[model samples]
Target: MVARVGLLLRALPLLLWGRLDAQPAERGGQELRKEAEAFLEKYGYLNEQVPKAPTSTRFSDAIRAFQWASHLPVSGVLDRATLRQMTRPRCGVTDTNSYAAWAERISDLFARHRNKMRRKKRFAKQGNKWYKQHLSYRLVNWPERLPEPAVRGAVRAAFQLWSNVSALEFWEAPATGPADIRLTFFQGDHNDGLGNAFDGPGGALAHAFLPRRGEAHFDKDERWSLSRRRGRNLFVVLAHEIGHTLGLTHSPAPRALMAPYYKRLGRDALLSWDDVLAVQSLYGKPLGGSVAVQLPGKLFTDFEAWDSHSPQGRRPETQGPKYCHSSFDAITVGSHFWEVAADGNVSEPRPLQERWVGLPPNIEAAAVSLEDGDFYFFKGGRCWRFRGPKAVWGLPQLCRAGGLPRHPDAALFFSPLRRLILFKGARYYVLARGGLQVEPYYPRSLQDWGGIPEEVSGALPRPDGSIIFFRDDRYWRLDQAKLGATTSGRWATELPWMGCWHANSGSALF
Candidate 1:
């Protein structure tokens, strides 16, 4: 009966791109569009002249570029996240510098530093390196673009990355007091006692003094955004600068966050192998043990036993690939699905229609039930059920009729819990097994899973009974047992299991 009703609801039109009834989302007005264009122009995202009144494809494309760089969903319209990012104050580091130029400069700087070290005879042949294991930092002047709370969170998260891998313990200090590390945002010419000053916007983004001195500065002229994928990713820049604060130097490795050139990292922010080795060379491994390596392929296979390693070489395009595990791992991207054999070889991406006759094109999300061997497909607000290769009766059902949210951003069935986890916005709903009969108390905030970000695109269950939620290019791992406890996470590309060769490529999203 419920399935019949759900089928009726599924027949209704879907609300895509904000609302079904509303026209395509456009710039709020001429003034707002101009502001958006100007913001991108300042950061070099917009090349052409700012449109006096922007409704053009050029303007929208520029906006999309910024959104893509920042790791926001690629919607060209001036969304709130985009606007918020445009206004955040940030370091004026230019992203236009060539990687070759940066590599050359950084190489020269390292040579000079090596010469200086030899002169002072400060190089120790081998031993525990960091002068102190515990480090403290304080923010003296907050930037106006982002709120103080946001800045604090960004800074804390950046520091947490280093702490996660090394024995270093970081604590927040009062804004006004003397601290081992002092942080501030400034315009051009703010002195940091190092005799160097900022060149305003379009030059260096931010810089940090070496360890023991512990001073970091941000150029106040640039707009900053705290959203992981909107403005400038403060977390990305700060993570790199903080490496310097910990006494690590620039890495010539392109994937290293400490590379001299500041590149838009897209959805990636985790430290690279070069970064991990350098920091451990300085501070030694974490007291608990060496940092656990995170690779997309690691959880499912025995590829490596150490941190800072991933499967190298080219991999198939996996952006928005729907992953499901029946007896073996299966993933779909667009209209194609690939079965990952037990031996770890992925079958060719075959069309879904070739295998499952009634399945719709471009499925947004999918989950396989362990109890029933059934596959659930979600697109917009509707869902379909399949057993083996055939569609179940009452075909495309409305998610809402089953008590699930309309247009879930992501969903997966938790076989152990006999519940379906539906994700939308900042919250997730838990429903009973077969259909979306709502759990007694659901729609819990994503806060339940510490370190998980909002707007998750999909999720995959790990062999160890844990689940990893993905957003943009990164992912967070949470043990099903400790739902409320903080779980470990890293960039999917950084882990060997995923076999991603570049920052933008990974199989975790969609």
Candidate 2:
């Protein structure tokens, strides 16, 4: 069915990096016309304009169309209100698809009273959409502020925000694996197109490819955050991008999550009625008996205060690695684990292969059971349980058998949950500490923890009962009370036990 173009309706402001195309504060008639022409052309309101009389006529008509869709006076003149509206932050996607989608959608809303099934049928034929119900996505890389686990949780929850309301299911593909969709972070021009290049920080925060292409790009320069109103909210932006991947256009509804401009996560549901109806039109109602999942705005608002937390404040012991001035040439190539005592004394480096007979070298992640006091070591796909350098019998089992990831990013005996938690990408696994078995509802999305990132080296359970995750030269300290990262910095300097502190410095630099 060729859907009829319905009446023009209101569409909220959409994404455009106002930074890349800034205008002087003062504007003359020519300036106003120039801005209007660019806005109309960029958003699909008008065709290319020239000095011809016909072009002027179309330009005036384009002004009226934009004014009408924006719910302003449709006098066909570039009035003050219309000029002000052009400056609003919006989605970078062309408005051409959105208006057409909304036109069909409005007609469907009207037709639903007489025929509901036909509404779905006609709208289904509109344009491009993924044929498969179950889709997979991979995050090629992410921002530095939040770790991979936390970022995964946010993205997973955003995807769930849609799948809950539609007949869709999404799973994150493994790194180095094929995926239907791939989300990545890039700064400046990483070569999608010059027009689509991210304009650092405030402007053109991110953009996504329409369906089947299945790609979304975020500006690494932007301060992308989850749960908080500060910085560009990554959760909100990714939700909007996820909508586009599911063949959704920018929404015309004021409250829609697909609106091009940034909005803080509110206390109510993330997906507006318009947003839900748009996706459902293409995918139909969710299959099976599950009810729709509407995440509360307060749920995001409560993802920890991202507290002004300081580390547990311990000074380096007098005896701990007194090589503050050691030359870089002293560093070895092989990985080594050294036990740092409570008084900050560093033990002699011990190789994993030497400490445990069966456990191989280069342990990926390790966690000591707070309950059993059994040291757990993970290498590649095999796991080893040890007690005082003695390997337990029948212990070098496959991680897959116990429901743990082959090589997890980090592992810790989470003090708050009191379970052995393992982090990989966007999902985390909980193991029965004693048996080392993945719990019943284990290997769940990391969205609950909300902001841990990928490729972290190790996790340390601190004496004060907090968890500190190590990645490169940095470490993120997870607040046990709130279950979120409160403080993060270089582990060598922030943590005195790591033994990289300057001997003469008595206080933290920050």
Candidate 3:
């Protein structure tokens, strides 16, 4: 209706202005006006009024009413902005008279039959075996024809909403292997051994297996979208499906997310009281921690590749490394850190303080010393040392005390040469193991060690004896022998394996 009104308004002006070339005004005007009237009647803009030849006054008034209701200007003319707004994608929820009438008839039927019912039909409910409080999920695959980044972001926001109200901790894992919850999109007839098959665009937007089943599937046929536009909102639908994955059934309340029908929800209305209570009943109350969600910029990774490539495959799983604790590795970007186990399990991300007490937030660089079995955290011009999980006494001293530069970009311990290396913009610094301070005359340029990244975000010694330096989305690999020698370095071959798969496609569960 809105489109037709806008089209007629624009077309009349064009016809009056002689802009529509060579076209007969009589035929064109009548056709356009008829289309406008039919659109209005179809969309319920006209109640019982039959489609008729409309005059300029009535048509323009109808357009004005539509514009006013749509929060547009009172002008009845179809402006470019209003025309564009009318054509965007939308949800599959149908408001046709037949559907409404059918629903009413069904309700009446059920109500009439209730008096003769022998036993009340029981509602489908979930069992008690909630997930392990802290759980992980991964996007096993993307739909063949959808925008990857939008889908990933929508999924992240959806999962984050659930984690906000429950004890659940969600993190991204490898899509190649097994995860607690595996997410994917499929077209018609996705063979899951179940007879249920996705019916193209209009029916069955998505579905999920119940808890412990650990599967979420979307119908690729639907035009899935991130925002409230023409297509189905992925966040809204996924949040509903994830409710099922977390042990929720179809809710009796129409407004609940777990309700059978899909409804558009704003960020504030993402979860309802029924949803919160249902999930909480299974998982207990949330731990009352900060909801740390990773936005677009930061990447997601796992240890699956490292475990497969290294001789110390399982050893890294049990022993502490320079960038991580014994059983888990920490991917610290900005102030948020997620603990990734060697087996690819991940904990919910938290502030630096939540993981390391007394350490200031937004740490610039960090490295665990192999000599003293302590971790050194660097931020700004100061550095703090941690013995195991406890901060050392009399700490957060100036980096100059350790012969380090202010605002170091990355740091790592080169155990073989027994030196702590730090990399900043276009330069590198090496400090020998000294109790009170680093040996003098250490900061050097990157040119000294073959061609390496001028600046890096983080670095770690791989079990294969190669050092990996991370800079933005990519990482460089350098052999151990080339630490101080001139040698051309290669890009990290395990980029995909390290969970840096898609440039903009990712979702951190927690």
Candidate 4:
């Protein structure tokens, strides 16, 4: 309706625009209601035809369908949880049959359980699959956040996940030739139509076409990540989109990889049991006729052929986002740092990297304070805390004498006690919300943190809330809630979080 209204206004220029602007839009519930309607329309929960508005009963039913698809309570009301879930980052594919499709998935699960060799169903009016067993894919581009090698490694691994269980095989397409599947990234509105255009961010992570079309598109606006448990894992998204390119539609089976939502990549097989069954039903088992091989695997390591350095290679002009050109003083007097900007009125803040060039973007010390849920940044003994858009309160506070050594080696949020931990030299300090200069028997020796040597560069928390500390190439994984290092090894190959994979694609040699 909004699109049609715009077309009408453009066609009838003589009509007065003042009358349309004269009435103020309602707020609170009315605003929520409009947003909900648009949300449902955008994702195919409701009909988008230019008919009279859906009756209240039909609209309520649409809300219930969205709730069911989004794994929320099936209450038809526009409750707070439903609204919040709608805002979460998710696959851009339309949920054309949100509720009924999920119900089919439940039935599909049971039917597949009863007969594993049942013929597969196709979802499209056009060709839903490839006739050839071998397929080649090429990356048109990649996100800047992760290294090219890492991204290709993730791609290879994602492709291998499918080939491991089915007859389908994939190989990287040569630079000069055509490929069966082409994956590309775009910022916004790259001629894919308004409905399919990549919305700046937060809506529709990526969209894909059926098998014969042989293409997948990701929103470059997304904070695409690798094996790290932050942002949207590109490997996971690539795996799911590959499913679409192979003619697999969205599966609402809660445990299936093709679910509309994302999940944290775990230590187990990336493909779920249902995912294996679905692909096998379509393409059948490998030529060897051996049992399906699903293993707890590593990221592929045959990256010697992949481009290591980007074509731009960190050039000064290409450092920042393309739209944000030139530079500014970036003035903010209070001890606060800028973050995400949802509204397009202002440019969104980039993650502080020394490579941004010509600007003071790097941070000396950074920590998320658990107490007030604000981010704290420290530079040259000066500190700033950001609450929201502004750095409220006169924060540029002096480094409090919080009983820790000067120039700590590393800082990470310790999930065990819900506090921040700082490592300096051979001692560690645990600081609570406004603690004393030092706590009793505190500034504990680094020895308590297992075999992690002093002067660790940084630390990251695992999905299970365990801490993995690293310096140079080595890492020590610790269950901080209990004992010392549970595992320690060379990080590049051993640690899954490093994005290194030992996976071998099941594709037969070409």
Give the TM-score of each candidate.
0.39, 0.52, 0.35, 0.54
- Candidate 4, overall lDDT? 0.63
Over 264-366, each residue of candidate 4 has an lDDT whose tens digit, in order, gives: 5432356777677667767888778877766432222122222234453222332222212111111111122243232212334444432122222324345
Sorted by TM-score (best first), the order is: 4, 2, 1, 3
Regions more than 4 Å wrong, model 1: 1-130, 192-196, 263-269, 293-510
Number of the top-ranking candidate, with TM-score as the measure: 4
Q: Identify the superior model by lDDT, candidate 2 or candidate 4.
A: 2
Q: Comparing 1 and 3 by lDDT, which wins?
A: 1
Give the clash total for candidate 4.
6
In model 4, pairs of residues that clash are 298-501, 298-502, 299-501, 299-502, 300-501, 335-384
The worst-scoring run of ten residues by lDDT in candidate 4 lies at 325-334
The C-alpha stretches of model 4 lying farther than 4 A from their native spots are 1-27, 48-54, 98-102, 108-122, 295-510
Writing each residue's lDDT as its tens digit, candidate 2 over 1-510 gives 223322222121222234223433245768778878877887777853344548779888888777766767788777666777787655667665455556666776787642353333212234578888999999888998765666776777778888999999999898888999888999899897777777776657778777778988888888776645356778788888878787776766666788666555543468888887777777877899667767545345322221112233222344234222111101111234566666555677666557567764445677788776888877567777888788875658777777678766677788666888788867888887564588888778766664556656578888787877765446788877877888888665667776565556644322
Please give the lDDT score at residue 122 for candidate 4. 29
Per-residue CA lDDT of model 1 for 1-510, tens digit only, reads: 999999777765453434522432354566777777666665556664355655577778777766655556788877767776666533343232223223444455568752222211111123313478887788787768665655666677678778877778899877666778877787777765433466555546687766666777887776666544555666667777787677665554556676555545422235676676567656667897665432121111110111111233212444312232101122355467776543344566688889878776656667887778888877667888889888885677776876787756677777657876777778888877666567877878878777677766678776778787765545677777777424544434444454333334434321
Each model's backbone clash number: 18, 17, 6, 6
